[model samples]
Target: MCTAYSSDCPPASSALHGGPAAPPAAVAAPVVSLREVSVVRRGRCILAVESFEAQSGEFVVVVGPNGAGKSTLLGVMNGFVRPAFFRPAFFRPGSGGPGNGRAEVLGCDMRSFGGWRVRKRVALVAQMVDVDARLPISVLETVMVGGYGRLGLWRRPGKALRELALSHLERTGIAHLAHRPFGQCSGGERQRAAIARALTQEPDILLLDEPTSALDWHAQRGILALVADIHAERRHTARPLTTVMVTHDLNALYHGGEGEARRTVPDRVVCMAEGRVTWSGPVADALDAERLTALYGTPIDIIRHGPRPVVLF
Candidate 1:
């Protein structure tokens, strides 16, 4: 459910997973999990999540109204936000598979001060990153910054980092802008660079915060398609990349961006209102008109013309 400080809240992960008794034998352990999570700031509670879990290769879309703590959820998962009272656990594969259930991240307890190591394995793209118009960094260089966390203090980036960054930029359809000034790029181009930067980390889990926000409709469609392509390509590898994105883009929520009737919806949907989760299930179940209207506190109508359900106000 959402973590908003409001009267209504979405249900927790248990509502969808059914009590969470080791996640069944066939299913692998969730790569990210939070229990009794709570974050407070300035004598005010920001987020409070009872239970949240995301398995490997799962594409989760978190949708909620503004100030619902959607971005904070991703922040906590990617190790950026330190919760006031919570233990966010990560199950990483060790040689064979995700071994014994450990309440640790990157094999170290988050409370143990070595939790910074966990950040190297995760990459986060914030909703907005301000870029000065006069900044001189190239797009490729900007993306290479993602690898710096793994490189550490003394080590300098080499040819390998450049190549990796370029490859990701190409995948994100920004190879042509590799040598261009990062600050001069368009809104869509910048978002592409941000995604490429995240990919350059070779992260186990990718966190995207409103990646399509501020972009035009065409750019939004393009970016969403690019994300889908990245997910599909990674699914064939030994360790598939897991993704969690927060967005208000109805196109993404409905069918992973419009114009692709063949494209599949996200693996799961988590709807939040007032910082509390209201729905957690398949896309079909989460798109009910009444539920969405109540979540946003506005009148919403749904029209099912074909397979896709269009949301109208």
Candidate 2:
């Protein structure tokens, strides 16, 4: 089911090829694990997941209708929100065997799971970064903020950290706007800067919340390309970065601009509805039109726009 967006999609690796079968390598301990996780706000249950796990270096995409808890899931990963009763574990880079270390959120146990150090290793880029462009900071300085977790309380960014931030800005294709006030750039530029900030941390896991939301068509395409580039560029590293992105735009799951030359789908997909994980598996099987229509409560048609599956009402 190839489409015009194939270029931007993930390669046809085994992870994208088969149904929901586990990969043959005897799955390593997941970088982040959740069990019986549930979130309640003001006595109203907003999110819940019985069991979830993301392997190191795998790309997972979360999608669902509005208010489906997609963003809440990302918040849970980095300890921004507290859950009712769930064991969330992180498998640190050099940690022992799978499930060897367990630390509560905001408190360091073994391997510093919760604390300032953990924040440095797990980067979360939320859509809120785009809402307030009047932050009164230059793009370069904004990116440097990502390093604050690593810098701790006393250290300034210094020369080396600034250079690293510039490199990431360049990688995300916004180096030219380094000195520009972040409020002055376009939506795309701000989103790129946000990504650059996240990359500055050199995080082990990157959690993105609807990076392409509220942008024009061109900007949306550009942001998705930037994400694919980040994933591809880090594929060969010893410890590749793992990413979990939440998006409501289903088209991003597949389509890309003409002649873009790179297309990649997520290795897995998690679909939510009314605060619970209704489906969790490979993107190929999880993105059925009928299934999504049920998930979104609208008539969704997965049509072929000259070879691609276009999921829309």
Candidate 3:
């Protein structure tokens, strides 16, 4: 957590004003910050966040029931969905002036900098997308498209780019399927390919929208493990990647099945409901049965499994 001064503290007087100079406080800026952000569609509000922030290199998992606005929050982070206050008048049709709020991603003001300008630095692996079975695009080719955002329209991908794409495919454990048609791969393989494609972008921020949804239990476990491995691997790099994943699977916060040992977890978890953040804190604190029950509007029981609590609905 970032340290912040209390509102009761007095403002520091400057030396130029004939007062002793106060030492500058050291505070790291958040990679993602939003205040009073809201998304309205067809005269209805879908997401409304009073304030949110994610420090650099932090892994945040968003969990909520269907229609709780979990995916909409991710969309706001990735700049795909502009806030009601930030949308242009033309985009809103009959709406008057822009709404009120602030959205900053990687130091760029989302209101003016625009999503396309920062998209190259932000890679998003959205939910599973069905592909035509006869499409001729190879898995390797599909992954290489991630780099096109940075390449722009004039430059063509060369040998180096192709090699980089292959390296990511290998890292994702899909090297053998590199030459296969993307549409032919299974759900798990396609998710892996999607991740490889996102990695090829060399993103600073990674946004995943239900990468494990619609898959079998085995496939879901594989995808979760893959995500954990990717997060761990990227943490050692000079520029550690910031990851935000949205999932409805509560068990994902732990490593194994119900009775298995829980060894890994994200830095934080944010619970959303009715277009608002109901809770945000460390994994341990956010997993309380009562808290979750209230958020999901359903009975939620937590069973103690050794040192970790497993969710039992």
Candidate 4:
């Protein structure tokens, strides 16, 4: 079992050890790939993506306005929302509706394998929910649910699973709150707990939808820092986790106002608007003032502070 903190696992590449490598390795398929994918809800198409790919160990950020289908894109990657494709009547071998498209996550055909199977390898921390204060589950217990996906319904979580959940709670800086009622925790604390739960899954891919939204400035920064540290830590592992985060706050690309470290800058940015990808490119190229201004339909400016660009409205 390759746990999140396993150190005995082999390195991702021999290049890390400066050893003479074998012949050039074959190009691996993308961890997440979607081609001609479209999502419809209530007789309306919410997301239509021609092509989107996230390479292994890459951090990609999806940004756009409120109705740009950013969350829907993440749903497609995590197998929550099935793509709607058109299939000929003759090709429909079953009672299922006609569909046409492809959505592959972690190399599995989501449509064929089912989202439940794909979710076992993918963890999603969706937007914060308003939990009732009287909910009976503790913070730690809530996180333990993540591991239940792998542990079949008949098997109870053993001591090892408990320890694993504790370690993640500690890693996310919410160990002290482990015993607290999940609903009683502050918004930021709840977000941290949510992240801890996702990490407990030991997933190959992490999907975050507005993890830092609806929080105070302090809590927002804390979540961003935690995410950065988690990503950095996973990079040293045998299988670095691929991340896809959706946020409307452009300033989140950098950390700490103006002159602070740009620890949160993702490897790439995918800008979406009107249910379609408006632009996709490296971080530097995607943060252009003109591009963002046009995307948001609002005047925007960018000013460099040290090595990072700060987005100003």
Best candidate (score: lDDT): 4
How much lDDT does candidate 1 score?
A: 0.74
lDDT of 2 at 257: 28
lDDT of 3 by residue, 209-282 (tens): 99898999988887887777777776755577888999888878876222232355588999998888878998
Q: Note the Cα lDDT for every prediction shown.
A: 0.74, 0.74, 0.80, 0.81
lDDT (tens digit, per residue) of candidate 4 on 1-313: 1113222344446434444775554456677888767788999888877678997778888999989999998888787787765443323366465545677887677666455577888999999989999999999999998899899879999888899999999998889998999999999999999999999999989999998889998899888878866876777577888889999878787662222335445888899998888899987688799999999999999998876688999
Backbone clashes in model 1? 14
Look at candidate 4 and give me any clashing residue pairs: 85-99, 85-100, 86-99, 86-100
Tell me each candidate's TM-score.
Answer: 0.82, 0.80, 0.84, 0.87
Order of all candidates by TM-score, from best down to worst? Answer: 4, 3, 1, 2
Candidate closer to the true structure by lDDT (higher is better), 1 or 4: 4
- TM-score: the better of candidates 1 and 4: 4
Cα lDDT, model 1, residue 67 = 84
Off by over 4 Å in 2: 1-27, 86-117, 129-135, 256-263
